[model samples]
Target chain A: MLSAGIDIGSRTIECVVIEDGAIREIRQAPTTFDPRGQIENVLAGVSFDRIMATGYGRNLFEVAYDAKTVTEIKAYGRGARHLFPEATTILDIGGQDSKCIILGPGGKVQRFEMNDRCAAGTGKFLEVMAEALNFSLEEFGPSALKAGKVLTINAMCTVFAESEVTSLISRGENREDIALGLHLAVVKRAAGMIRRLWPGGPIFFAGGVARNSCIQHLLEKDLQVPVIVPDNPQMVGALGAALLLEEGA
Target chain B: MFGLFGSATPNSNERYGMTIYDDHYLGGIEERVIRDTETARAAGAKVVGVYCAFTPKELIAAAGAIPVALCSGSDFPIPLAEQHLPRNLCALIKSSYGHAIGDSCPYFRATDLLIADATCDGKKKMFELLGRKRPLYLLQLPQTSATAESHAYWLGELRRIKVILEEETGTVITDDAIRKQIRLYNRLRTIVHEAFLLNTGPIPLLSGRELDTVTSVAGFELNLETRIAEITAALGEIKERDKDDDYIASVAGRPRILLTGCPTTNRKVLHLLEDCGGIVVAMESCGGLKTVGGLVPEQGDPLKNLAANYLSIPCACMTPNKARLDLLLAIIRDYRIDGVVELTWDGCHTYNVESFQVEECVQATGLPYLHVITDYSENDTGQLKTRIEAFLELLN
Candidate 1:
């Protein structure tokens, strides 16, 4: 049997096709205002017996593309567990929000917490800070690693934090120090959510922000626990959507 | 189709997409409120506007005045409120203040006296500001009710309110009048409690959203007898429909959720949970079953009865809210709730802090609990839906 899954995230859309419980093809693209159109080109020649959708725009896909909808939490849980079978907690930081999901024995979500209507702990926040600091997002992580001192960025609001960073620059604060402080502030926000759940199992980080080495390092240092990042963390939601087809079939 | 205020006609079902079933239980609820208020005013009855549920409604009713809840759940007046109050206060507070200053709430405009209970810090300060525009009475509520002296202090405060109501309305309130009002309110509470019991049945005859709308509307309806009769008839009709195959299939085996947190005026959060296959079996928020939880003794001194009931309503503002925890455990067991969802409105520092303690208490029962800190914004709808769906997935 063949099945296809699509994840319509805030900033991106990912689709995966699985045939006989094996991943056959993986494709991704920038999410457009019309989620269905964003995936139309990526899914040009792909067809499957069933199509499932997950992520921010999952609800839109059901009526627009004749697909089934699953929440990103369930999709991420299934996808993270598939890669790391022993993972008991999954921390997924997407473009606009961050979340922590506690998994049970069968990879079911026991409890979860998400950033509350704030962009401080999200990728968009980092992108804005990176632009203000005149550094590409790719250079944000590695540059922070070489900082001489970690300045404190107390303002959690992105706009306030940017002005604070600019003032810090004017106050003769080192650029590397400001970059590291920004990374620390973001991770601190994410960690606050994680500590709310205080999951006792292995922590596996997923989502677009998990690719940042600085965040992963800070999380491990703050949590005093080893953090695991799966290969292709951004595709976890789509992968989980595909796996749901096999679980029920 | 006359509005509760008796000035405007009720909107058509097509405009609200209201089904016949919705109309049966909750049709023209706001209209009924206005009509009830207008009828009471025409009869030379004084109208008292109350902000907190902890205020004894029977006391105001005893003074031959109609007690109406004045908290505004409307979003349109929030900007107006922000002009006067801080921009980052609770949405309900801002909305209420805006409605008062902007003259949007007909109920507030009709009120002869406004009673504000210092339930939370934001409200306590906001009421001081609102006093500039209206005749405001602030009732001091004791935060810790564990001591004998505290009970007496609360009783004394309620009596002072009773005196204030009597003075403001120019009516002498007899003890017999207070006792009669207590009995009437007790019957009303019974009616609401029975309606809540409908949710505990194997197949709930009413949805949580419908139950909330019905009961919360009852709080505003000065004519309790009519409200009770309508609710009783609606439940009877729903009980009959509960046997339908499709209705049974729709609700059966859904995740049973117990919502405990701040008042959810906008029911989109509840609807989102149910849409994701989670049936809300019970709620402990401000507008939920707590509205009916104040069951005072029918045969007692009016002051003591009112005092006991006021102190018994466990608000998150109270330190060491053990009563709330006990009540939550009882509701969870009685309703067979599978999970608990605690939502704290943004900038509601009291409930936001208490949510962690609630989480700890609920987790001790071995049931999964999810704490969602949010506000009345559509931006977080997808996120709230995802977290609730995942929590339900844990139960299944």
Candidate 2:
């Protein structure tokens, strides 16, 4: 039997199809204002017996496609455990939100915390700061890794941090140093959320933001723990959903 | 004098395949209440507005006046209130003050007098400003309810407010009148408490929103007998529906949630919780179990009895608020609650700080607990939906 899972997020859409308990195909698309059209585009040729949806726009997908729905928290917990069988904690910094999940024995979600009603410490924050610094998203993380001394960016708000970034640029500050500071600010907020949950063992980092090497390196340095980023980090939610359907969970 | 008769319609939840009996006879009473308050005022009946649960409603009734709750629970007037108040203040305080100064709340416009208390520093200072616009009377409440001196001081405040009520309404408030009002209010509390307890069944007969609507709308009712009759009728209908086996089967198996914290006047969080698939079986806030859990002694001096009963409420304003924790644990067990969700408004320092102790106490019971700190805004609905859904998943 084959199962399909789709994650319709604020920034992107991911579709994962699995057969015989292994990933068969993975597809992705950018979710503009017309997410329904984007969703149709991503799943044009994928075929599966059972399908599930998860993420910010999962409800819309459920209504439009008559599919089952699960929250991203449960999906991440299941997905991370499937990839690394011994994993007990997971962090996902997506487009507009970040969540830290602590799993109990058998991969049941024990406790979790998410950023409240803001885009301060997520991929959206990085995207905005990258634009303000005139750096492409692909080069933003690699550029930040080259900085020597990090300048402090105290404001975590996206709007305020953008203005702060502009001021730092005007002050003849190195763009690389300011970029590193912005990355550190995001890492600081994410670390605070993880620490509050009292996580132990290795942290399984997923979602679009996990692709940034600077955030992963800074997170390890700040928390003094090993951070694991899976390949195709953005596909974790969709992969988890498909895997959960296979297990009938 | 608000008309009590209205067309009643039962709200159906298609998800559960059941029809929830709606006792919404009290809906749309605001305009009628305003018009009625005007007519009654012209006929020499006084209307007393109050902001906290500490003020004795019986005293206002005994003085031949109507008691209306003036605490603001909306986000509409908050920006207007921010012109004079700080933007960082509690939304409840800001909304209440905004309603008074903006001349928007019909209830505030109808009140001949306003009674407030020193529950917290924010509310106390805001009341000072509110006094400038209306005939406001501040009740000097004792900080601690665990002392004999505190009880005496509270009794003195009640007596002082009683005198003010009499002077303002030009009515003689005798001990007999006080006792009569006490009996009437005690009955009202008993009936309302009984209605709230119906949710303790294996399947709740009324949803949380329905329970909230019934209790809050009933407060606008000035005629005690009519209010009691309407609620009693609604409760009876619910009980009658509970006897049906099919009705019970459809609503069963949802996680039962108990809400505890600041007054859930805005109800955004409450709606979100239910919409996320958890039934809020009990609420321990001011408008819920906290204010209605106890009754005053009928045989004692009325003012002292009122003081003792009202003082014993376990608000976070008290230093050693063990009573609140004790009440929470008891309700958790009695309601068979599957989880606890504590809602605290932003800048409500007392409840905000008290949530730490509440979390520790709740976790010790081996049940899941979630503490939501928010303001009266819809900006966080998406985030709140994810949190609430995830919390409910934890229960499963």
Candidate 3:
């Protein structure tokens, strides 16, 4: 039997198909203005017996395709546990929102917290700050890691932080230092949410934001614990949905 | 078939239990009451507008005046209110002040006098401004309900309010009148409380949205007898439908949620919770079970009884608010609640800070808890949905 899971996020869509217990195919695409069209493009030739949807646009996908839906929190918990069986805590920072989930003994969500209607600690904040500082998204993380010292950024609002960055630049502050400061701000927010849920432990960090090396390094250093990142962080939700279907959950 | 409030008639085929007392009927009643209030006011009937649950409606009834809730629950007048009030105030205060100054809200327009309780700083300062536009009376409520001096001060405030009511309505408020109003209000509260308790059964007869509409409309009804009859009939319909095996099976396993926090006047969070597939079996807010759960002593001094009953309301404004935590734990067990969702408005510092103790209390009972801080706006609906859905996942 084959199972499929599609995570339709605000910025991207990830589709994972698994046969029996092994991954068969993985596909992804940008979720442009027309998400339905983008979703159709992502699943062009994927075939599966059972399918599930999870993410911000899961309800729309459920209605349009008559498929089952699960919240990203549960999907991430299950996905993280499947990848690392001993994982008890997970932090997922997607494009528009971030969440901290603590799993029970059997990989059930015990408690969770998400950012409240803001882009302060999510990948979108990093993307906006990258543009303001004239750094490519690819180069943003490595450049921040190369800074000698970190500048302090107090504003959590994306718009205010962007202006703060600009002023710092005009004052002849090092660009790498400003980038490091912004990364530190995001890391502080994510760390605060995780700390609120769990004590010191290895955290399974998964999402598009986890791809940024600066955030991962700062998170591990600041929290004084290992931050585990899977090979394909963005596909965790999709993989979890598919695995849940395989388990007949 | 009123056009102003849309159709007051319910589509017979909507849902099984809610066909009798749905939003259409409740909304129609609101429109009719507004028109009826205008006619009565022109004929020399006095109307007293109140904002908080602390305002003793029985006192208004004893003074031979109509009591109407003037607390605004919409986002429409907020922009107008922001012109005078700061944008950082609670939405409830902003909306209430906006409706008064903008010449909107028929309930505010029909009032001969407005009464406000000094519950929070935002509301107290806003009442000072509201006094300029209308004949407003402020009740100096003691912050704590734990002291003998506070009780005496609250009783004195009630007595002063009685004098103001008599002077405003030109009617003598005797002890006999106060006792009669208390008895009538006690009966009303009992029926409403019973209606809310109907959800405690294995399967809820009415959804949270339907229950909220019934209670909100019942709050504004001038005729206690009429309100009691309407709600009693609705309860009968729900009870009869609860016996259906198919209906019970259809809604069997949804997680039951208990809401506790600031008054959910706007119902944004309530709608989001139900929309995310969880059943809000109980609400501990002002407009919910909190106001109706307690009753006044019939044999005691009527004025002192009114003061004591209203003072013990367990609102966040009261320091040493241990009563609220106790009430929440009782509701959680009695309602068989699977989780607790506490919603505090953005600027409501009292409830916002009190959420810490509430969270600790809920987690102690081995139930999951979620604290949501938001305003009456649609900007965060997407984010709120994800949070609510994920919270429900914990229950599953």
Among all candidates shown, the one with the greatest TM-score: 3
Give the lDDT of residue B70 in candidate 1: 86
Task: Give me the candidate number with maximum lDDT.
Answer: 3
Which segments of model 2 are wrong by more than 4 Å?
A: B1-11, B14-24
> Model 2, B1-396: lDDT tens per residue?
111111111223432222222324455567768887888899999998999999999999888898999887899999999999999999999999999999999889999889998999899999999999988999998889989999989988988888888899999899889899999989988988897788877777776776676667557877788778877876776787567775566456668999999988888898788777777888999978998879878897888888999998899998789999999999998888999999999999999999999999999999999999899999998888889999999998
Candidates' DockQ values?
Answer: 0.70, 0.82, 0.91
Scoring the B chain of model 3 against the true B chain gives a TM-score of 0.95
- After superposition, the stretches of candidate 1 with alpha carbons farther than 4 Å from their true spots are A200-202, B1-36
TM-scores for every candidate against the unseen true structure: 0.93, 0.95, 0.97
Give the backbone clash total of model 3.
0
* Model 2 lDDT at residue B121: 88
Q: What is candidate 2's CA lDDT for residue B262? A: 93
Write the residue-wise lDDT of candidate 1 on A10-126 in tens digits.
888998888866898899998867766787876888877888999888878887877887888888888899899998888999898788888877887777777766667799998
Candidate 2 Cα deviation (angstroms), residue A195 = 1.1
